[model samples]
Target: MVSYITSTQTLSFARKPHPKEEVCGDDGAAWDDPDHTWLVISDGLGHGAGAAKATEAALSWITANYSNNLEATVRGCDKAIRHTRGVSLNIARINRSTKATDYVSVGANLGWKVQRSGIQRFAGDSGVVGSGVRNLKTTRVDLDGAGYLVLASDGLNTTSDVSALYHSTFDGDVSLAEACLERWTTGKDDSSIFVYRFT
Candidate 1:
């Protein structure tokens, strides 16, 4: 399969509670040095301001300290919210030089993929965030084989039927990603997604 080394990112957030409840939020950024870019999504435990603040804090911390060790960053975030426990996150670091990607999660949903010609998926942690769970995984891409990194919260209700969005085609992942999130994020919890485009 042909791979891509491009990196593109897009995200969507749908307000929940059908009106005021917003359950999800996402953010991402790449470095100019080609060292790596960061993608992070944090689902606050509850709804309203409390949830928003929790998720916001998580992303802020990630971007602020992404230059450090990823595992330490994950562990640090977990320790800070031991009591409030309003965070579920998936943080990925894509390195241009090594073609290595590292992911750190805490009670968040796992990841899914739309490889150039294949589909892969991972599940979520059973418990809530702030439970002192350190679930992390790292993968290396061919830098020219894979094109996108797709991740979403469980609210999408699409655990089993993701084929419609992740077909084997040359379609841009940002477009496909937004379409899927718009369809899946309709619950009380806000629906959020983060897509990374690869070169």
Candidate 2:
């Protein structure tokens, strides 16, 4: 029950298992640009060295090569982690001018908060990068004045109740993000979360 930071407009944070010896490999990033804002979370398989490599590789490609082409970005990430593989990734990018968000994602589950509203949600059936293949879909959402985002791995919980969780938390505490992560996650996998809790 950590009091993770939640603010108006721009904010981001995450929690992962201790790296190295522990199999806790949580990979994540965020960027708010005049043209766009982007955030990524990749959970590498296993723990320690291998997971780190997979995560680092995926993140490097996504941030460096994210452009107008969402499909291209997905392909690039797949290719980068062909050898070391993992499931669950949440990539969110928001366009400043249009107030639109293009989410190029694969695997597990993701969620959102509209400032004062509680956490809403989304998920992928099997979004994993491997053999460096590009198998991603882009989802576009119109943003209100301000909204928050949470990219969580299945490790925290299974993805069975994604849509249900969204409808339920309409005016709850910001800590609800942590609630979803802990309540649903399996715990067997390496669980982690990268959250951009905004106002």
Candidate 3:
């Protein structure tokens, strides 16, 4: 078996709802197989029960079929949740051997990579997954060496301060991801951030 040194962290918070509400509006999953690592973030439509249902359906498909190609995996998820409210999701895959990263988005959540060279941003197109995507794009990037990758839900502002991610020592600190999650929280809705440090 081949091994790559990689660390992952995820931060998720629920949206405040009416007194009777008891569910979070967003969900995410991250995992690594022998060959591939995946990061997924989903926001259900709206901010309560309906949204939670949509995300559950979407995540079920994502978890089961993530081994497939990025486009096909997303299409499968879309079909699986068509009966529900629908969701906005961002999916990312990293090939452990090649250090190649492929990501696709069908909603408002987005992804970014911080590398010694520069930062690469991946933004979503307009559409709700499980409903229909009028426009969308798949992005591919190669990790040169050690780098940090972040995928965030719409609750967090994309333009907020990210200087911490640029510091060279960020990757060395074990708490790097936790500090980032705190710095990026928008506090307005159900928010989440998935961090991957690949070496």
Candidate 4:
């Protein structure tokens, strides 16, 4: 697990490998610039080292050539890891001042925004990152007030009610992530969860 704190937001990430595997297939990263904070999650196709390799390649490309443009960044990641097993990818760019976020996702990854009122789900375009992308589009949402942004790989049960989990066990960013992983992980594949809290 890793955590990042800023003046406006706090982010926490946690991941676990499949029970039979030594390496996790899902990976993620978060970084900040003067004007924006970036978050990314990548889940490779299968389990074990090959899947880990694909995720590592995608994250490395993003680290070396970080960009604020969500679509272009996803395309670049697709190109960078074309040789390895393809991955499911999601990227988010949040404005430091306005709290508006631009998010893009490809493949089966999941995302949601949880506020006091309700939970808003974010869906990704249908395609694999390294293989190809179709109907690529960026979704925008406002994170100005208190809320939580949750991103998870398919290893976590998508059918689970995250809003209920948030409301019941909401302590802080780190605890929310830990609870989600503890309660929802499928245990058959690599699992990852990212929770971002903004006020």
Residue range 1-199, candidate 1, lDDT tens digits: 0112234333332223324644334333333235765566677775666766666676666556655477677767666666564676766666766756766555655466556576666544444455576455444444356555666655556553455544534335545556666666646465556555565
What would the per-residue lDDT of candidate 3 be over residues 41-66, giving only the tens digit for each residue?
89888778898888888887777666
Ranking by TM-score: 4, 3, 1, 2
The top-ranked prediction according to TM-score is: 4
* Candidates sorted by lDDT, best first: 4, 3, 2, 1
Which candidate model has the greater TM-score, 2 or 4? 4
Model 4, residue 170: displacement in angstroms?
A: 6.1
Q: Give me the runs in candidate 1 sitting further than 4 Å from their true place.
A: 1-34, 123-131, 134-144, 158-160, 166-176, 186-188
TM-score of each: 0.72, 0.71, 0.82, 0.91
What is the model-wide C-alpha lDDT for candidate 2? Answer: 0.60
lDDT of each: 0.56, 0.60, 0.72, 0.83
Stretches of model 4 off by over 4 angstroms after superposition: 1-9, 170-174
Residue-level lDDT of model 2, residues 1-199, one tens digit each, is: 1122222244444445642355457667776555776767777766677777777777777777777787777776677677776545677776766767777567654545444454455545465676544446677766665555666665665443544444565334654545555565665666666555443
lDDT of 4 by residue, 1-199 (tens): 2225344446778899999998898998887889888778889899899999999888888877877777888888888889988999888888978989998989888888988888888988989888877679999989867888888998988886877754585545556677788788988889998888887
Clash pairs, candidate 4, are: none
Residue pairs whose backbone atoms clash in candidate 3: none
Question: Which should have the higher lDDT, number 2 or number 3?
Answer: 3
* Candidate 3 wrongly placed segments (more than 4 Å): 1-22, 168-175
